[model samples]
Target: MAPNRWLRPEVYPLFAATGVAVGICGLSLFRHITINPEVRVNKENRAAGILENFAEGEKYKEHFLRKFVRNKSPEIMPSVNGFFTDPSRN
Candidate 1:
């Protein structure tokens, strides 16, 4: 007998058809889950909107970092330094 003879030829087509059906169902389900309805509707302008949001976030992050550094005083420095120096504090 052939190595693959354990599965009869008659059942092979059934397995192939089942696999194709399952594959199509899986793809449809995955698309339904991952795709946002709003994004799908405005697909034409999605890239531009995403880029604008990303740029806005970067500007906010820069402003926050600058403000944080400018507001840091000498009084708060010692506590920050001591936290790292003393191992027993852990």
Candidate 2:
């Protein structure tokens, strides 16, 4: 009797990677279904529905990364931006 070929130490990483990929895809799908207003709202009250949907959307809140950078300078490196923008520094 031969052991299962799929059950091997070398193939474990592949299984892990596959699981992670599937999990990410599942989460993305779930997020799209739940959070996407366009998909949630229908034609009956599209005008009001969209507005309401957007209002609900706002309640869910923005991503942490966006909130972190909101109202922040667009510059990636402030020193470099200052060096180029400051006439006195030239």
Residue-level lDDT tens digits of model 2 in 1-90: 346777889999999999999999999899787776656545575555435456666755676677989999998899988999999997
RMSD in angstroms, candidate 2?
7.0
| Deviation in Å, model 2, residue 66 alpha carbon | 3.1
Q: What is the C-alpha local distance difference test score of candidate 2?
A: 0.77
Candidate 1 residue-wise lDDT, 1-90, digit = tens = 775675888888998999999999998677555553324345575655544356645554466458777866656578888899889899
For each candidate in turn, give its C-alpha RMSD to the true structure in angstroms. Answer: 16.0, 7.0
lDDT of 1 at 58: 56
Question: Stretches of candidate 1 above 4 Å error?
Answer: 1-6, 38-90
Return the TM-score for candidate 1, rounded to 2 decimals.
0.35
Lowest-sum lDDT 10-residue window in model 1:
33-42
> What value does the lDDT take at residue 63 in candidate 1?
60
List pairs with backbone clashes in candidate 2: none
Q: Which regions of candidate 2 fall more than 4 Å away from where they truly are?
A: 1-3, 41-61, 69-90
